[model samples]
Target: MRGAPTAAALTDRLTAQLRRRPVRAFWTALGLYAAVWWLAAVLTQLNLPLDAVEMLTWGREWQLAYWKHPPLPAWVLDLLYRLGGGSHAVLYLASPLFVALTFWAAWRLAGRILPAPLAALAVLPLVGIVYYGFTSPEFNHNVVQYPFFALLPLLLHRALAGTPASRGVAGRGPAGWSAVGRERDWLLLGLVGGLAVYAKYSTAPLLLAVALLLLCHPAGWRALAKRGPWLALGVFLLVAAPHAVALWTIDFLPLGTPAMRAAQAAGWVERLWYPAWFVAGQLVNCLGALLVLAALALPGRSEAGLGNPRSALGFDRFFVLWMLGLPLAIVLAYSLLAGQELETMWGAPYFALLGLAGLLLLPRAPSRRGLFAALGLAVLLVLAGLAGYLGKNLFEPLTSGRGMRAQFPGPALARALEAEWAQLSGGAPLPTLVGSFWLAGNAAAYGEQRPPVFIEGRPERSPWVDPAALAETGALLLWREDEAGRPPGWLAAWQGSLCPQGELVLAWQSWIELPPVRVAWATYGGRHCDRPPLAAR
Candidate 1:
């Protein structure tokens, strides 16, 4: 009885503290969670994933836009490297950092609609979801869009709620219409929208969803008729003007490349099932979080909380449904009509509001016990994901011959390539690596000089490379091969014809279980010191 009383006292104390400082507690948990993942990354020395490598390669130049995606993620990566000394640890933190921003945004948005404790509860399930934790190590465009998705909902709620006091009492009238004409709200909305689009084209779904919701709802249609929507549009155009120009300059190459066009040509069966496959994958991805939430929620309680669909006060529920449902519907419809192969991961950023959706599905609010349970489960799942990531990077290769990219001996290969380059070029520093993105990117990252990487031997994809300067400084034309063998047919022919005298084979061992991974490398123009300044190109 004494022990039980002491435990109760301690629990009460914690409950009091949590009540007093909910926001602080939320942030502290987020920071600790991020630290755990970052430590795992550092300890394992995890190699950057393929997309991350491409991001790093693209980020090195700080271009207006990369060949594949928008420029913000690359810009953020470049900024992180500049700020944190370009270490791999710094690169790995990009995803966690963005995810935390998303969590904060979600918490803020939830606070708008729910009590502080319930807001925290709503965010717990989201953090448990695999999209935010397990698959977030790779800081791709999808991860980059998370914060924006969270922010869009938050801003949209505030704008639609029309709190005139928040917007400086712009023609105060009814609560719903008070801030409809406020220039500040429109401008902010437009700014966030433009930035979201600048991050990824996938953000268009949220944007389209918001526009369609407004057109369908009477109040929203009235608000849209005001100057707010027009102002927002003008601001979006102004903010997006540079990217529009960049797109035009590049002849809209990012829009529909050969790969995308090929995807659009998928057979009818594939197209018909793609939506179903996407839905199934999403369910699988969120299964862990769903289980945790189910444990927290009451048994057999399944109902949409909003009653009376025609009530004016039901706008908030309608807003949630529109935001969550319409985007999904659009994706499903597009896949069905276009006959395109849709990767399930493309839905990564679209699910940030899943916790709120989960809340709507419940019959009642979660109790304190349920909240703590959900949070505990989420933390465990995150740690499990982190452990799996570490195992993949540090342990898997020791037992299996299958080489993981994370275990690749980038530094070893880089050193060997540098030595061969020095011998071939007579002391000239390797200025570039021309090969497939992964091979060259690994070498570029780990090599002493940190040379620029030209993706797929193409200069346009690598804007940093000046063709004339690359010719003057020379590049190591490199490609992977089967265990100390020669380059593939095309690469071998290219090497044999272009740099016959400079051929070199590198026996790079990424793991002991497997045979040494070989790279065929050839030097091009390092013979001349008349190269352009490294900084200039």
Candidate 2:
């Protein structure tokens, strides 16, 4: 007991260290994020998630807009892929990099709301949230949106408060127009806001929230009336112009996609249910996050030192309510009215402010004991998330029956298809594949064939494939294998309709399993291949 420090002594030491070294504390948090995610990425190298594959395939095409989503993630991935010289390992860095920037943004915002050590403490709960760790490896649009979302409020705060040189550099923007003082911050906000929108239309809620805040708060209204807001709006519009043009040229193709159409057709009951379901999903995801913050609420040594939620005043209170809360409310309201189900991943970037909210709502400044407890909870969750991810990677295949896209043997199937094509066409370019996006995308990304994918057996989705050339060059049509080793029942019927003269055969097949699973493949058009020639084997 002689060497054991008293509780008060230990608390004093930790508080002193944390308060004296806020920057070091932030880097420590960021270091944990990078190490944990990078380890998972390296260990999980055998397979790429569906979203990551989609980004890779779309990145290959360098398209202005993808069929289902905006182009930012694809654009960035494309650049990263090229920069990585086609190394898949480079893709792993994407999520963690964005997450680090997001955390930095959150930390900066927290500094404005709390003392240095407390600001660092504020971010711990958020870092433990699963979205920033487990789900981020996919590095989809949601992950891409994280930094922008985190940066938006911070920029808005600086612009609104006329706080100079705190959030962004003061200078002339891309338009070659110099903005000094308040206008500089507003200009940068516009740019960030515009880029966020380009990243995903979901960012509209944040922009809407900003608008509401300006209307509701007198100071915000005054700031908006100045040249800064207008300049910001102009910059935003300019940044968004290309996407708008792309949408127009295609008649807003995203709105007409099957998913959107299905949502549009949902009834009133479904509409109400969708947002309710989304809110519920958010709660589930935030369980670990909430637990970390709850630890901060435990009674500490001094009541006055414990910050109260009601103690938040002026801009901080407005920020918690409008900046953080309003966007979520708008998303829920829109989902309910539209009856369109929001995917759980869409909520990934929306909670970057959770830590700031946690700090502002505390009735008193956190005691050292509470701070350490919250950090412990956060570290516990981070370890759990990492363990779960590793377990899935290690044990998932052994169990079988699970057909996660990552577990698919895309490279082997691709090799098999290439050999099959060489046998049939005497080694011309593999040309194209007519199939659903998932199968075709995997083949293109991981398979050596590098054939273009015509989604859903339709040519329109693959504009890069020349219709005439594809006809001459031939194609492989594929579908997922059913439980019984046959193609899915509906695909079997479609195959019959597609090749009335030809029979669907198990042209190529591959398997992977700690337990054992297989994907079935078939050919449709090849030079040496004849129609209706093969019996079902």
Q: In model 1, which regions exceed 4 Å deviation?
A: 1-18, 163-182, 257-269, 299-313, 419-427, 483-486, 489-493, 500-513, 526-537
Report the lDDT tens digits of candidate 1 across residue range 1-537: 345555335434444555677677778878987787677766665467787777777888887777778899878887887798767788888988898889888888766666565566567777667888767877889899998878877777766666332233455434455555466767788899889877988788888887786677665676776787778889888898888888888777777742464466358788777788889998888887686777558443222221211222245566666787788788788778877667888888887777766665665655445544555677678778887777777677777757777766676777778886677667777777888878888787766677788776665677677767766667767776655554555464343324533334443234356656666565566564343432233
TM-score of each: 0.85, 0.83
Q: What is the TM-score (0 to 1) of candidate 2?
A: 0.83
Instruction: Tell me the tens digit of each residue's lDDT in model 2 across 1-537.
Output: 478886567656666667677688679768878877887876764667788877877777876766677888988887887798767778888988999888898888776656666777777888667898777778888889888767988888767543222213334122332343367788899999888876887788888987777677765666655788889889999998988887777668765653554454258878877887888888889888888888887777632333344443445665755677888998888777656678876787789988778777777777566766876777788888888887776666557545455556666666666776677667777767767667667777766545677776544455566656654566676675655766555354345423322222222122443334344555555464554522432
Clash pairs (backbone) in predicted model 1:
474-525
Distance from true position, residue 170, model 2, in Å?
Answer: 19
- The clash count for each model shown is 1, 17
